[model samples]
Target chain A: MKSVYIVDDSIISPLGFSVEENLQNLKNNTTGIVEVKDTSIHTDSFYGGLIDEKRLTDAWDALSEIASYTKLEKMMLLAMQRLLDKNPQLDITRCGVLISTTKGNIDQLKENNTDRAYLDTLASAIQQFYKLGNSPTIISNACISGGLAIAIAKRMIQAGHYEDVIVVGGDLLSEFTLSGFFSFQAVSPKPCKPFSKNRTGISLGEAAAATWISGSIKNTNISEVVEVVGEASANDANHISGPSRTGEGLYLSIQRALDEAKVSASDIDYISAHGTATPFNDEMESIAFSRSGLEDIPVNSLKGYYGHTLGASALLETIIAKHHLLANEVVCSLGFDELGVSYPIDVIKKNKAIAMQHVLKTASGFGGCNVALVLKKVSI
Target chain B: MMVEDYKITSFCSIKDNKVIVDNKVLYVHEEQGTVKEFTKAIYKSLGIKYPKFYKMDTLCKLGFLATEALLRNAEKPDNQTALVLSNRSSSLATDRIHQESIANKEDYFPSPAVFVYTLPNIVLGEISIRHQFKGENAFFVSEQFDAKLLTDYSRLLLDTNKASNVICGWVNLDSNKYDVFLAIISRKGNTILTEEQLNKLYHT
Candidate 1:
């Protein structure tokens, strides 16, 4: 497979809008989950990783072309603009943009009581706003959408179609999702605690993350950059919201990703698991990892710091893992004080020093969909 | 990604435990349960291994039933398979239910469980679990069906040996309407199809 590298990344979450700001907060264990004082908008005491209004406005000003966009669109444009600005060397024409989100401006539709054509309008808005004439692909694969976005870009680049692809994923905590999570009984009253013995449910977060991928794109002296080695998606066909009790879908996704990478379970240095803190999700993932004989690998979930950004989770997690890989350190699984599931696997609770090579990123979502990706550090 | 004979084994629209198939008219503006019920009825009659009641969704039930029928005649591919699901309205029904909760001030608690289905690709996840296919999978959205894009993507997956076989199709459910056409496309050296062939089979 052709090598695909991460050239640049930018993020806007509760922590801050820039990549460096988010990373700095993460190092200090600063969580973006907070109380929403505006309960009148939705009668729920839920926590969300909301972006600051002033920062968001400034970000919109930077990408003034999208000034007319709604709140969600502005948030997305801000992330994209920051990423594009960071990598001005690459020509946008030779690149393709892949946007991933579940409800692409769906909030606007709900507010206006419009029809389904709202999606088309959103796509057009993006095309005109970005000033890109090429066809841009949008993915809304639940929580796996962000990771799948990278996988799609890798396919296009590996197929010798485009050298560079801009992948931007974002989602907002609209009343639509707030009610959905509440109806399902999966919302955490407090901040989410992934893989915690006292864990209750996930905290919905809004975030936008952008990453530039290319064969030629590179940063200064960054040898051993994170490389997309392999990625795969699998369907559970077992349930809609509930995961397969046997972890069949997750097991298949992991197996396929490893096969594509031509690497064995023992080769992986660590695993950035999709520990959603939900009983079923954590249990299913543990069983799947054990089934794959990956029980010994160090693992952690970033939900404690970033909450579940839905479509943005996978890419955001990958960005965090990439930073860890580059720094030769392992991030602890925040909020995991106890092993809540029976499945046997080591969930890292402390930062450990190690020479990282290849790590796995796994995520599972509704409709029994699961995806696994392998990232290898490109050695000098 | 040349056209070849695409077999649709089981086309189901299920709800609760009931299954509906090709015989039932798919409603585009009705309750999700009606669609699920119609799909479940089809699976019951076909004698396929019935999925557990609680674990099945319209997407999984329909996808597996279709996949079972598509692969009934041929053996499972010896190599990994690619899954390409194209759509415009993905998991809208789930989104609707979620939206309703938020809209209702008295009962404004959005259930996290329902929130999970708001994702468009969960259908793909259901399909993967049913077939136990752990391979290259993607969900691409457009204003309308893009046959050229689908063909190109399928070709890319097959040509690169990403998967020896490719199961690509369009599955969408909005309101009560369910319109999906799935196909199993192996390498040209391995399989074959033409527009005339599909037109004759589905039309005539």
Candidate 2:
């Protein structure tokens, strides 16, 4: 099997437009989440990480494009362009594009004609924009879409389907998602506190995170390459909206991922968990980590900074994890002051320098889906 | 890479008011009606007492019924049976309903029940809970059914020992039009499962 390497990446979010800027903000412990008061999205004030519209517009304007595009499209296109620019030698014809999004143009739902609201339409627009070789595969498996896209890309490359795959995960904060989360009473009133005793619930956010995964390393400009060693997804088979109290699915996913990577739980150095901060979700993750015998590994949830970007959450977090591995420093699990869950997993409370080679990225979402991906740092 | 040979153990298709299993018509409604009515009729014919079926959106109902039919006579599949499903519309049918509930401020009342189905993969969860399948699963969206993608993915899972069995196909619903095609692929079966075979079954 071919080893999948993350050769290049980019992120467009409230914190910054590039990976370097985002990493700088993380190192400085700067949060992108803020109190959002947009009536168009919600009736009352809520906390979320929203990109500066003016800044985004200015960035898009610099592209000098004559075509009109939606906010989500602009974010996705800009992110992909940045990644492609970094790897100018990439052959577009041999590459495959995989889009991970829960809701593409969902904000376009209010219009009388919702042709643009289709997930495939969002993918087609990107395909046409890049004139890529193949139609983009759309992964809409809730929050796991982003991380799962990376897993599938690995499989596609290993199976000799493509030499390189570009995975882009993006979602927008619209009334459609906001009202739904509010209806579920899962939205936190303040900045999200993942795995904290006082944590209330998730803070919704919007972002576009893209990465280039190849069978062989490219982009010699980078110092180190992050290889995707093992990836697996499992369904809870318990509930669609709620996570299992036993964390059965997550445990299975982690075990399977570890097995595939030919590594033990003790081999993992850090964990980037899907700590949505909802009491049930955080607790479930703790239980799963305990079951996997990884309770001693330092775990951090970036939700405090970017909130929950839904489909973009995992990919964005993975990119941050790559940087963490490159820098050999683990960022703080922001907003965590006290242990919240019953299990005794080590939730990183402060940014600290540490020697790390292997990082585990896990995400669980609606439809009882859970994914675990094992990433290892290899020197060029 | 060495390829593994797999077979289609069972198959089911729900479309045009007809329910077909393994190339045999199991049930067909004579009267034209809404997707809701057609799905309800199919559920009644199946005679299974799963009350949760009533609450699912049209897409889930379609997928749920198709899976129930696919595994009706066969032995219970392994708990590690993965579900790889795809469709073009995604959960747009339920998304439209959720959008309508919150579209107007005066009538804003988004029910958690309706909002949960807004994701396409929820159908997989519903089927998983029903069959006690705690296995790998994924939901993909394309302009139309892509046999190569589904087969390639399912083959990867089987070849890598990630899944014991796979229930893979397309289930799409939009504007009252519905189509569902589900098949169980395993190491044991009569017909070989491949991209060409899946395409033929989908067209059938």
Candidate 3:
């Protein structure tokens, strides 16, 4: 199989608009999550991480000339443009475009903007505006969509369909999603605490982040090469809203990814888990990791830093994981006061520096979907 | 490049309130009713007792019924079978229902059952659970039924050993409109599934 490397990336979140800023905030132990009383999305108070609108608009206006796009559109476009600006040598017209989201423009439903609620509209608009290589393909398998997008891009590249792919993942917090989670009683009132003894549920957040994955380094001058080695997606075959009692799906995903990456469980230096902080999610992940012989690896969930961003959470966490690999450090799994889950697995508690090579990223979502991707930091 | 060994083992189509398997019509609705009623009527013809059928959204109901007809006679498939299904409108049909539940002023309450089916891929989960097949699955939202995309991706899964078998095709559903086509793919089968074959099966 041909190699696929993470060439360029950008993250737009409440923590910051740039990768450097987001990384600085992570280093400083600053969280984007906070108590939000936005009755527009929910009637009662809820905790979430929301992007500052004024700053977002200001940043977009300074760089982009088009103002017809919605706020989410601007966020995704800006995220992609930042990467495009940094790598002018890359060709937008030749790279595949993959957008991952559970609900795109879903906010339009509440505002009577049904025309924009179609995910195809958002994808086509982005494709036309950027003149992407091909019509964009959307992965909408709940929260695992983002990780599956990267895996799909890698597969397309390996199939020799495209040399590069731009994967942008984003979702907005709205009444539709908020009410759905509320009905399920899955939203936390306070900041989300993944793997904590008192962990309640998820804290819904929103952000748009993009990563430029290339099959080779011939097009641009990128030095830090984090190659996407192995990836697998599986269904729990258990429940739609609940996780499997045995964590079978996630365990299979990890095992398959490890086999594809040609590495054993212990070879994985660090793990960036999909700890949604929900009782079922964290417990399922622990069982999955422990069953896969990943019990002792330092695992951290970025949920506390940025509330579960839905489809963007996996890619956003992956971007941060890349930063961890480059710096050879592990970020603290915030909101985790004590270990609370079935089975036993090492959960990183604080920011610590350590030499890292290969890292594992895993995510599970509604519809019994689970995805695992192994990223290797290699010196060229 | 297609997987040389793979072929379409079986396929079924459920649309126009008719359940057709391998060009044979198994059931057809007679009365004028909503898609939900049509689904219920057709599922009754199967004579199977899976009570969970009634709770699925229209999209999943159609998909489950189609898969049931296609696999009724076949042996149990391996757990590593991958599901690569696509659609045009995605879960817009149920999205509208779920959206309405939350958008109403007087009855403004979300139903977890309806909310769970708001995403298109929940059908994949439902199918996996009913069959106990845990494997790689994805819900792709395309502009339309792209047979070439389905053919190439399905072939890749078999060739790369990502899945021993694959259940792939387009399953689109919206209000008063739906086109569901599911095919069982594997390395040992009678008929090879090319782009042209997929197109033919879609319109079959």
Candidate 4:
């Protein structure tokens, strides 16, 4: 019962440090992804979306005096601080925090001496830094962690566990992830082209996104409230590293999400897909869209701009989708020049204005995990 | 909202080189050895020929063995059964291995097989594939097993009709030490799956 609304949010990424800047970049078709030649991350130059180090340090210095925090922690805290700043009336002591991250302080493992590398320890640092009421729960379910965090927050609020919950998702580009993706040959040498015929692979990125989910929209400062209508996650039960050729898990997730939202496939206006640009991933998504009878809906993958931020990907895109609903426009799927995949799904090629009311966000990742969240716009 | 009382239909745990199902010790390895040897010994004792078990990392192997024992006699659960697992280390054992592969330039050969198991939820995926559980699932990482959180989440899923049955508990593996505690929670069973009871089972 209770309707959960994403009342306030913030995004810290390569494009910008705030949601406004990120949205402006999206509207201008400016991509944050570039050719990165950091030998510390990989042996060869690769494409990725990396936040400017000097800018990040300046932002952190302006906010806190705590210098011991890791880069990923600073990003998460900064994103949360921006959201909290927007809602001065929010009671931090009464809210629960859910952290969505695949590898928390994983880069610290290089020294092989830091205990803060543990996922729970990362949550503890955030909890102590904010003095929140409850110990922050860490969701580390591959790329679906962020979206699943939102879904879990919705359940917690609806079940009368917490009136409000703060969900923060962040991951960084490190030698660990880069080398692993490179090992799999999943890294693209150029800016990723999602759903494009010539798409190579995913361009890994680093970003942090935070959202305030509440049972009531009292202290919100937005014109339109984005309600988390329905959310569901399903496992492919197929392969660990590879996606299902039939898109079985993704189709189930979408179907379950739509059913729970009390809407049919036709009711969906836009789709924010997890287009990692890998040949198999894009093709799997296309088949899932067709199987769900949503082949004609305009779908866009923000990876063209933000790349695959891993755990931060779904939540970041969901926040952007909320902005799209508020502005009544569909941002273009950047880097897409030609139709790709066997199924004929309508991938958004250019930005266009539309009267969007409901949008679907889907993400599938390693370990055969797939999640879908339904968001609806409501006038206050 | 009307809340429903769910029960722990079956429970199993693996720790200290011993396998216990429903409070009964099924198998035990007397000699001290690595986690891999212990898990493989348990697999052989289970007498199942699932070769995929060999490919999984230690975490997945521990979780798979526990689940196999938990559902040995019970009827096969349908796809509506969701998995909600928690752990502390979060694949750090595998993460260190993956990190070591690329730590040196001369020996920089990161194998995809080893890299794929670097997530905590991959264990969930392994159990899902083994049981054909094509339903909602999530993996949480806490400093310790928080029975209250798991109970609350599992109840929410069952209350909302999102899942007919939920296999929820903790499976943690780190530094040659592994502990797995899993239980099937559903609408029908002899014992109510309360937070206190689940915690007691975990500690037992």
Candidate 5:
């Protein structure tokens, strides 16, 4: 019956490396998705949310001379470092670490003769580097992993074992994923337009986001304090990769979240959707929102701003939503100009000022996994 | 931390387009594939249904079966439940297969069919659909079995009231074999089980 509040958040995406940079771009509606000229891909035009490898060198100093660490590690370390800087009094040992990622050094896997050694090596290296050997845990539940990571951390803190939880979610785009999304016919040739009549597919992206959650109030400097009140998950037994036409899983998850939070569907002020821009994903989410009685709520997807960051999507989007909540402004759904789906809803097209006391972040993924987390602005 | 009650509902596995279970062997007559096929066969048997599961790779199939079993036993909770899951390699196996399809000259074609299984939490998606038990869901990867972590995570969910019921477990699948187990623990005092009790149930 305790509450978990967001103490701090950090994001490193194509929009820019630091949280401030991404926020500035988001506020200005400057998208990071762009056409790729790489020859490895079959498509001549592809948009992706890419990170600056050159900017990551600054994070190398935090590394403990560990040879096994990869670029993704440094990205996560940098984001977390920034988060700690914002809230220096956080007790790392007392906080549970929840990590959300889809592919961990999978590019290494693609290289012939590589065993599963990368996992142990990376985990150990991270633990040693952060001195978080006992507290770290990783979540790899496909796209919903980020949202789920926050849910897990909230769970542990509520259980009384940990007072603070550090949730980190990130993934790097490699040939491993580009080929897979390409194979599924799910990759958008151009920058993705969520809920557009001509919406193509999800543009791949790579980024890292870290957040601090706890019940105790530590930082007074934070402008807006948001509390994650309810969380839920469900399985869509319908298909492996495709979602159920009814969106039964998403509906169940949201309903459960509302019930636990002791709130009604009408109470939600806004919805930070998992509009991946894929044909089926956008349509299904619209339908789910409608069926859940969220038709009137303002909806938007951050995909245009950061591409589909995969593992980092939920957390990154959550961080964006946090910033918006603090700023008292909701960024418009960047690439959406029309209500492409049959479902009746209002998709914001421009940055709008609104008094949002509660917002719901929703995401669904391949195995028919659906997750929804409800956040309330705390009146500290 | 108590499981008032739980059940395994629908379970099925698909290998070579045929479904197999504890008693049925669908591939006994087939010539052979490889160790991959054998591993797929094990995953196929672990499921509760065949036709629907045929499309999924190992990770999705294992998650679907385990989550289906979980919902079948426990009634749809009155409130939202939390999902805390763990796997060893995530979707690396499917990623490897997908990567091979494109990188190899002989098999330069990419199948959207095969590419869809690369997401680790696809099983959670599948479970969300079947049970409509949406609360909080998360999947984690560990070097080895660690039930303490699972219990600790579940306790967090319960204590925060972020989830009144937490369905937590482990489901791992790769080229060699697969193992799956899940439980829905409640924050309510009734029908609770401690970490030690849950560990015994899974390990023993």
Candidate 6:
């Protein structure tokens, strides 16, 4: 397989827009989650982490001459624009864009509904704004779309599809999702506490994360990077919203990824788990980690700080993990005061400094989807 | 990376009141009803009492019918069958309905059952649960049915041994229009599932 490297990246979230800003907030334990009482979403107020409107629009207006993009489009464009501006050496013709989103502009249906509400339109808008050669590809595999996008990009590059691919994933806190989750009772009243004994449900969030992955080293301009060693996706054949009781799909996903990387559980240094903080989701991860024999590894979920950003969670978490791993540090699993699940797994509460080498990132979502990505820090 | 060629061992297409298998019409519905009612009629015609079929939106119903038709009799290891599907519209059919339910505060009652089917990949979960397909799966959205994209992705999944067999095709749905072109891509087949073959089959 061709060596796929993460060349450059950017994140636009409530914590901050740039990668550095978000990392600092995460390290400082400054959660973006706040108590929200938006009438458009639910009858009662719910806690969520929303991007500051002023900050978002201001940053977007700076990059875009006219603010014609939708909220989700603006977020995607901002994240990709930051990476594009930073890496001027990238060839526009050879690069492709992969967009991952569970709901892209589904909010567009709420008002001024048009064909533009479709996902491909959102992807095309970004592609045209950048004037890329290859048509944009949209990965819409529920919440795991972002993680699966990385895996898909790696394979496409490895198969000599494109030398460079830019993946930008984002989802918004629309009434559609909020109402739906509320109907499912999956929204947390407080900021989500993943893997906690008292953990209830996930805190909704919105974020856009962009990463430039290249198949060839010559295409990359970054000095320090992370290599995507292996990745895989699996289905539980279980419930659509509820997780499998045995974590069979997630365990298989992790095993397949490790099998592809030719690595074992002992080789993993740290784990970035998909701790949605939901009763079923957290327990599933524990069982999956236990099944994969990775129970003792230092594991953490960023949902406590960022909330569940749906499609953007996996990519956002991966980028943050890449940053911390490069710095040889492990982030805390915020809001986790006590272990909730039956399986014995290490869920770190505070940041731990270690000689980070290899890390495992796992995510499971609706439609019984699970994705496991193993990333190795490239020694510069 | 070089990958071994796989074949479209079996395929099914559903549109209007007819179901075509491998470019040949296999079943036609004489029932007169709306798309939902027709879907239910077709579901009954198969005589497979999977009661969950009625709850699905037009998207999942079409996917469920076509997939069940393709894998009705053929038995294989459930864990290796991947459900890789694409669409021009990403769950917009159900999204519109979902939007309608929540758009009006006066009649605000977003059914969890309906809201759950708002994602395009939920059909994958529905089918996986019904057939016990515990393997790699993904849902892609594009301007139209992109055969090359589907071919490349399925090849990757199969080549990596993540999936022993793949149920790949397009299941596009709107309020009135619906079409499903699902195929079984496996090692033990005659017709090689090349990009050209996929394009030809998708157009049917």
User: How many clashes show up per model?
Assistant: 48, 0, 0, 0, 55, 0
Q: Write the per-residue lDDT of candidate 1 for residues A1-380, one digit (tens) a residue.
A: 57888777888888888888987887777888888866644564677777778878876876685356877777777787788787777666668888888777767656754553245556666787767786678887788889888887888888776889989888877667766666667878888888787899888878988898887645445556788888887767666678788888788888888988889999999999999888889988988999999999999999988888888889998888888888888767877898888776899888788788889999888766788999888765
The docking category that best describes candidate 3 is medium
TM-score of each predicted structure versus truth: 0.85, 0.98, 0.97, 0.99, 0.85, 0.97
TM-score of 3: 0.97
> How well is each residue in A167-211 modelled by candidate 6, as lDDT tens digits?
999999878898998888888888999999999998999999999
Give candidate 2's TM-score: 0.98
Give the range of the ten consecutive residues with the poorest summed lDDT in model 6 chain B.
Answer: B71-80
lDDT of 3 by residue, A104-216 (tens): 98888777787788888989889978876567888999999889999988988888878899999998877788888888888888999999999999898899999999889
Kindly give the stretch of ten consecutive residues in candidate 6 chain A with the minimal lDDT sum: A216-225
List pairs with backbone clashes in candidate 4.
none
What DockQ was computed for model 2?
Answer: 0.89
A228 in model 1: Cα distance from truth in Å? Answer: 1.1
TM-score of chain B of each: 0.73, 0.98, 0.95, 0.98, 0.70, 0.94
For B1-204, candidate 1 gives per-residue lDDT tens digits of 222333332233333333333334333223345767766655655666744533555655566666665665556754367677777676666667667667767655666656666666665665665566656667777766566556667767777666667776666667777656666666433224433332232332
For residue A360, model 2's alpha carbon misses the true position, in angstroms, by: 0.4
Which stretches of model 6 miss by more than 4 angstroms?
Answer: A219-224, B73-78
Q: What's the true lDDT of residue A204 in model 4?
A: 91
**Candidate 2 colliding pairs:** none
Which 10-residue window in model 2 chain A sums to the lowest lDDT?
A61-70
Docking class of 6: high
Report the candidate with higher DockQ, 1 versus 5: 5
lDDT of 4 by residue, A153-193 (tens): 99999989889999999999988998898888888889999
Candidate 6 clash pair list = none
| CA lDDT, candidate 1, residue A82 | 83
**Residues A12-45, model 2: lDDT tens digits:** 9998999999998988999999998899888888
For each candidate, the DockQ is: 0.44, 0.89, 0.79, 0.87, 0.47, 0.84
